[model samples]
Target: MSSLVKNIIRFILFIFFQHFVLDKISLHQMITPYVYFLFIIWLPFKMPRTWLMFIAFLLGFTLDSFRHQPGFHAAACVLIAYIKPFLVNMLIPQEGADTNYQEPSIKSMGGPLPYFIFIAVLCLLHNAWLFFLEAWQFGNIWYFLIKTILSTAISILLIFITELVFNRKQKFRTNTI
Candidate 1:
């Protein structure tokens, strides 16, 4: 299947699973597992910045619509989408890199350590921005901090489990019109 088609399907499935399954499960008021961000993180390396942000916005907006929080998810998603390139560049060194790792995944990232770091950093960023925005105040800093940490850990674990279970290398073929 084409890359576009694969991504489209992934987008739908992630949103559906997040809203129906993940959102309903309340481990606590704080530690919510968010696998939806994985969709944005897994996007192709060569995707243009504008499109990436646009897609992130759409993904977050969809969740916002469902959850009744207007811009929290949208803003957080866009923030990570904006930072994704820099984070990938920082974690994946330029020396002797494999060009074929076109998307962010365990195989593409060389090993579990680097991939875990990448996911952890982004998950922390996402959870921090998201929970803070939801809180809308620094009055309870510790609350937000603990919430962010717990949520990030859960999200990272879920993401890794997802990667392991469906560990298929995606092949992207360019089409000529």
Candidate 2:
């Protein structure tokens, strides 16, 4: 399928996975792993930073509306979205950037090592912000730390599995995407 088609499907599937699956399964005192942020991470390498922020806001806002969490997720998503390009540059070193990849993957990004680190950082950031906000009123440092680590691990594992499963092999070459 085309990159556009794959991205649309990725967006929808992630929403369903987050809202219907992950959101519904509350871990209570434990951590709740979220894989939905993959949508933001999987966007084309050369996509505009501004557009990434917009889509991140939209994605988080939609999830917040569904879960009635107001601006919490939206805020975190925007933060991650804003830094995505910078992080990608640092981690992947886009001399050729493989723009048509459509999603961040080992096959497209050149190897599994850099891609894994990139995904891990984003997952940790998303989980840390989310759990920190959720635990704000309570003010439990341990919970925040534990939740971040646990949730990040789970989310990263899921991301790895998803990447392995789909394993798109196409690469899009462009200037500094």
Candidate 3:
């Protein structure tokens, strides 16, 4: 399938899952496990950096509109979009890359280790920023820190599980990194 089609499908799924599913399944007093940012992670590495941030803003705004959170998600999403390329490049050195590839996964990354670690880092950053912003002004430092850690860990695990179950890499091929 074309990258455009894949991204469209992913966007739709993310909106539905985040709004109707994940958003509704919050753990009472705990932070929501937000795996929606994985959509940005799955985007092609070769996608234009500007377009990535634009789409990230759009995606976050769309989700915010649904949840009525205004600019919170938008800001977090833009941050994720902004840092994605650099994180990917760091995780998988460009000089070591063997092809003008697209998307991210064990296949495109030429190994499971780099892709998984790369995505984990990005997800951690994304969730930490998101939760911290939401918890801003709250004076309970321990609560804020623990919630961020728990929520971020849960979000990352959910993302990893979703990718493994979906096997998104089946659509991409990269023999070398």
Q: Return the top candidate by TM-score.
A: 1
Q: 58-162 in candidate 1: lDDT tens per residue?
A: 999999999896898999999999999888878775543435656877767778888889999889999999989767655688889889999998999899899
Error in Å for residue 26 of model 1: 0.9
- Regarding lDDT, does 1 or 3 come out ahead? 1
Misplaced by over 4 Å in model 3 are 93-100, 137-139, 169-177
Better-scoring candidate (TM-score), 1 or 2: 1
lDDT per residue for candidate 3 within 1-25, as digits (tens), equals 7779878998999999999998788
Error of 1 at 84 (Å): 0.5
Which ranges of candidate 2 are over 4 A from the true structure? Answer: 1-5, 99-102, 172-177
True lDDT of residue 96, candidate 1? 30
State the displacement of the C-alpha of residue 137, model 3, in Å, after optimal TM-score superposition.
4.2
Error of 2 at 33 (Å): 1.3
* Candidate 1 vs candidate 2, lDDT winner: 1
Root-mean-square deviation of each candidate, in angstroms? 3.2, 2.6, 2.7
How many pairs collide in each candidate, listed in order?
Answer: 0, 1, 3
